[model samples]
Target chain A: MSTGATGRIEITDLGIEFSRNGRTVEAVRAFTLMTTPGEIVALLGPSGCGKTTVLNAVAGFVAPTAGQVAVDGEAVAAPGADRGVVFQQHSLFPWKTVLGNVEFGLKMRGVGKAARTAQARTYLSLVGLIGFEHAYPGELSGGMQQRVGIARVLVNRPRVMLMDEPFGALDAQTRLTMQELLLSVWREVRTTILFVTHDIDEALFLADRVAVMTARPGQIRDLVAVKLARPRAATVIATPEFMALKARILTQVREESVRALSGRRP
Target chain B: MAPAPDGGWQRPVRRVLSIGFFFVVWHYSTKWDVDLYVRFQNIPTPWEVLEEAAAQLRGAAFYGHILASLERIWLGFAVATVLGIALGLLIGWFRLAEDTLFPPIELLRPIPAVAWVPLSIMLWPTERSSIVFITTLGAFFPIVLNTVHGVEGIDRQLVRAATSLGAGSAAIFREVVIPGALPSIVTGLSVGMGVSWICLISAEMISGQFGVGYFTWVAYGIVKYSQVVVGMLTIGVLGMLSSALIRLVGWRCMPWLPRRVKDGG
Candidate 1:
């Protein structure tokens, strides 16, 4: 895979808090991580472990309460084209067609109509959504909507793509197909990605590194390197090495899940 | 036995039957000996009202009254739509605008449009302008408030997504804010149209020299109770047509909304 230059994410002592009903609730605290250019890293944790919060911080959606998040040595402040985000829910504008949604970023940048349409068409085909260009988001199935979301972000050619469980809402069969589709896309356009999910299998299948986080007030508890060979097939999950890694990660995640169930604050 | 599914003719048949039932009740009620019937004894029978309506429809004066009422409503409704959308977008998007403008609007919104008649008459030199002003007031609040609600209710993630795609505030407002709030805006328009008709009739009754409302009032003054019923029926038909037109426009603009919702199911 040809790795594109420009994507490198760094987070140092990142903390995020939400004030609800005049009560301060810390979502993430003292979290720190780094990704090399074109690296695929997954933030794997329990449902409310602030994995999405960390991803949002990188996407510049959430302001860090403390520390800093930077991309390519530049401090993250506001959302920009350099960092594209794919939300868990299908956030495609219902009013816009699939092609229109894909071309939105280019339109924002003032790209010419002909050029942007060509670029949008290219990305839509990349996600295998060529014929459905004129369809509205509401008409598509869950998996198809997420594909449009992916195409929309990819058209921007972002340095770093922050996906917050992009396929979380899909059925198992579709999720598997999407994972494979993502891997293929990543092979062609090697942008750095920070994928967030509560699914252990998804994290292992997609990321070069999986950073497992704790329960509420989440902090990185473990970072396991998936040394599995590139272009790994879906059959890799059945291999002995994959099983061994799964067992190890499962034990660590189960410990945190137990703590969360017991009403313990991390 | 299970009921048969409705056939093609069922809907029209049901409609005719319901309307026929109303006329039958009205016909008998007017002739009743009850104390309630005594007060309504002067009210015309269904056949008398229909005959008066037929005579009015054949005359140019009736058409003139209809045209005048329509002209006033169109002028007032057009002004209300433009001003309401502009002000609503400003109030919904900018915090400073909201804080500054919303309080006064909230205070004035509760005052009925008819209550503005006295002030409207003094504010404008012409009777036509005064009636238009009162009609504009009726349509404005619903459109503005619904638009504000539409803007406020937009999903935050959509805005974030647009911003992350490098959309500036202007682009976001045009591409995202407006389209996202459209469903509610259309709802506002439908409601605004209804209220505008109400205000138009009232204004015409009070101040107009040539309108359906004025015709009804004059007929009552002359004791032409049959002609008054005809005017009332004409207003009802016109009001229904106007609201339906607004809904049709809304449907065309929003193709993404479900068929059921667009049809107002």
Candidate 2:
């Protein structure tokens, strides 16, 4: 994969809090991560560990209470096309056709009709959604919808593609297919990506480095770089190197999951 | 028997039978001069009412009455649609607009449109303008309220996604807020269409000299019971047809919505 020159993401000492039910709840604290241009990093943790909060901070959907997020040294104060996000579900505009949804960022930048349409079609074809341009999001299956979501994000050629469990809602078979699809697309586009998920296999399969996170008010517990060979297939999971890394990361995640469960009880 | 499958001929057959049963009961009641406490004794027979409807259809004056009422409803409904949607979008989207505008609308809304007849008559000089004003008043609240609800109920995630996709505030409003609120806006329109008819008819009965409502009221005063029934039926048919037109138009505009399943189901 040829890495793009400009897609670096830097998040430093980020903290986030939410005021819910009249209480200030700390969701994430003292979290820091950075990626080289076109590197894939997965923030792996149990649900509610504020793994998503960190991703949201980078995507400019959430403001950090302590630190800041930067893309290519430019600080992110608000959401922009520079950081494209693929949400877990229901992110597609139900009213817009698949083509329209993919064309949205280009349209916002005032690209002409012919140029935007051609560009959108290219991205759609990349994600294997070439024939379904005119169909609405409501008509597509869950897997196809997320394909549109991925295409929509990639069409922007974003500096960082932030995925918050983008395939979390899909069935196992679909999720595997989507992971493969994402890797192939990432290889071609080579945009920086920050993926957040709780699934161990997903984290190991898709990411260059998996940053295991602590319980709520989360921080990185471990960052394990996968040394497995590239051009990975589904069969790579059975390899000793992949399994050893999974075993190491699995213990950290299990410990965090236990802490997260106990922390919620009282 | 088990329920007929959906989209079957049995359902249509049952619907036809249901209407036929009502008409049969009506024809028999009037023919028998059934004098319950409610009194069907003075009520016109179905045949007599049909004949009177045919007679009215033959007259130029009846057409004039129908046209006058229609013109008032069309003018009032059109005005209400434009203003209600504009005001609703504003009020629903921007908090400042909501705070500044919503209070007065909320205060004024509960006063029924029929109650506005006296104020409307005093406000506008022409009878036509007065009737239209009342009709507009009736239709406005529902349209504005439904639109506000629609806008408010839009998923915040959609807005976030749009913003992250490089939508400015104005672009978000046009692309996201407006379309997201459309189904509800169409609901408002359907309701507004119904309310406007009610207001028009009441206004015409009370003050108009040239509408179907006015003709019906006059027929009652002159003791033309069969013609009164005809007028009532004409109003009913027109109201039904207009509401259907709104639905048809709404359905056409929202082609992206799934056909088999109703929205919010």
Candidate 3:
């Protein structure tokens, strides 16, 4: 038995449009989506593909111009403790130490100082940052910083974890280590994760299902389930099923990109 | 890398040589009997100024005058700081206050504190209290202006982070807003010290019975040029000391703000 049988996230016919600089940008075009219980769903797309925008919509950062989003049975009206979000840029407050950042969500949830510190330390151990509790975010390397970022989001034990390009900023070696670290993290909590990324390999490696999206004014073209076995290791990268899914997602992305460049409506 | 000067008696030799150059020039010019006001013409000689300053320094009245002026400066500065920071934060945080209070403050800020000399005199019957009032007004405007700028300059993200973390208004202000606004508060303090120093001198001349400003002004009335020079030097020393004290207090309060430069400016 693996840690992959718990929470759920549901998104229905969501749409978002914004007016910036006097121009109407249809940032999200009639996005309809869902991720079932205990599943890691990856929103795969290129830059300007509205992958982040869709994540924002679901996270309650943006008002949907069209549809509905629900976690378990409740509709999200604003950012809350129940749905933890890790931004693409790692928006950890610079003034706080590693422990402080990890304890932020817990503190907001009204947990006592003693209990929050203890729980935060537990999550820190899970992410291999147990010893660096007092270190500031600026004092750590990019990968170490992101590990704190993951640890900060994970400790809350949210029903749904919304991540936007969580590893897009790391170096290649760091990215791979982070991918392994993320797998171990998922194996522990198995919270319903909607992880957004442009990296096909990362999506293949972690996600139980990958929803590859069409380019800007973005729409979901396909949501393919990755049936790869869990306790998935770094060596999973060399497997046939991994490579095969990579090829399929690549084709979907490239086709959508061409259609996007051709000025044809996606 | 600046090494120590090569000569064993370097600093003492340099100091003596500079003084020697000045006296030699003065003594020679006086000895040659140049028709021009050579050594003590309109400006007194260095020796004469020192002698008069030493004589004044020995007097109890001189210390009393210095103490009087110093008292006014501190009192006015203390009052200005609390009022300025409170008003600045209010204007910065609330849109209604910015609209209602700031325009009036801007109108009053440009009027010189000296102009308030007559106004303060009319408002208060006593000369000593009047001088204090003017000095307070002088320091108040700059403190308020800088504080408002500082409060407005706070990072928006920090505010959002606090609110999202469930911090109420009081905690947000005490834990976040004050510390975040401290660097700017220090800037305001430094500027206000300078302005108060300037206003204190003028206020002293107008209303003081015995102070450095009054001593200097009174000396000008009688033509004791050497004593006037001494009084001017005293004011400069006092001003420097006061500014240093202001910066010391600032440094103590805002330990997070970097201390790379002492703009004792």
The list of candidate 3 runs beyond 4 A from truth reads A1-7, A88-90, A106-112, A130-132, A254-266, B1-41, B44-57, B124-130, B160-175, B206-212, B222-265
Q: Candidate 3's residue-wise lDDT over B15-98, tens digit each?
A: 999999988776555445456643434666667777898898788888888888888888888888888888888887778999
Query: Cα deviation of B133 in candidate 3 (Å)?
Result: 4.0
Name the candidate, 2 or 3, with the larger lDDT value.
Answer: 2
Mind giving the per-residue lDDT tens digits that candidate 2 earns over A1-266? 34438878888898899999999999988888889888899999988999999988888888989987899999999999999999999999999999999999999999999999999999999999999999999999999999999899988889889999999999999999999999999889988889999998898999999999999989999999986778999999998988898899888888988998999896
lDDT of 3 at B55: 93
Q: In terms of DockQ, which candidate is stronger, 1 or 2?
A: 2
Q: What TM-score does chain A of each model score against the native chain A? A: 0.97, 0.97, 0.93
Question: At residue B224, what lDDT does model 2 achieve?
Answer: 98
CAPRI-style class, candidate 3: incorrect
Over A51-92, each residue of candidate 3 has an lDDT whose tens digit, in order, gives 888887766667778788788768867665566777655366
Candidate 2 differs from the real structure by a C-alpha RMSD in angstroms, to one decimal, of: 1.9
> Where is model 2 more than 4 Å wrong at Cα?
A1-4, B1-8, B261-265
lDDT against the true structure, per candidate, is 0.91, 0.92, 0.79
Best by TM-score: 2
Fraction of the reference Cα-Cα interface contacts (below 8 Å) that each candidate reproduces? 0.81, 0.88, 0.10
Model 3 interface DockQ: 0.22
The better candidate by TM-score, 2 or 3, is 2
Error of 1 at B230 (Å): 1.4
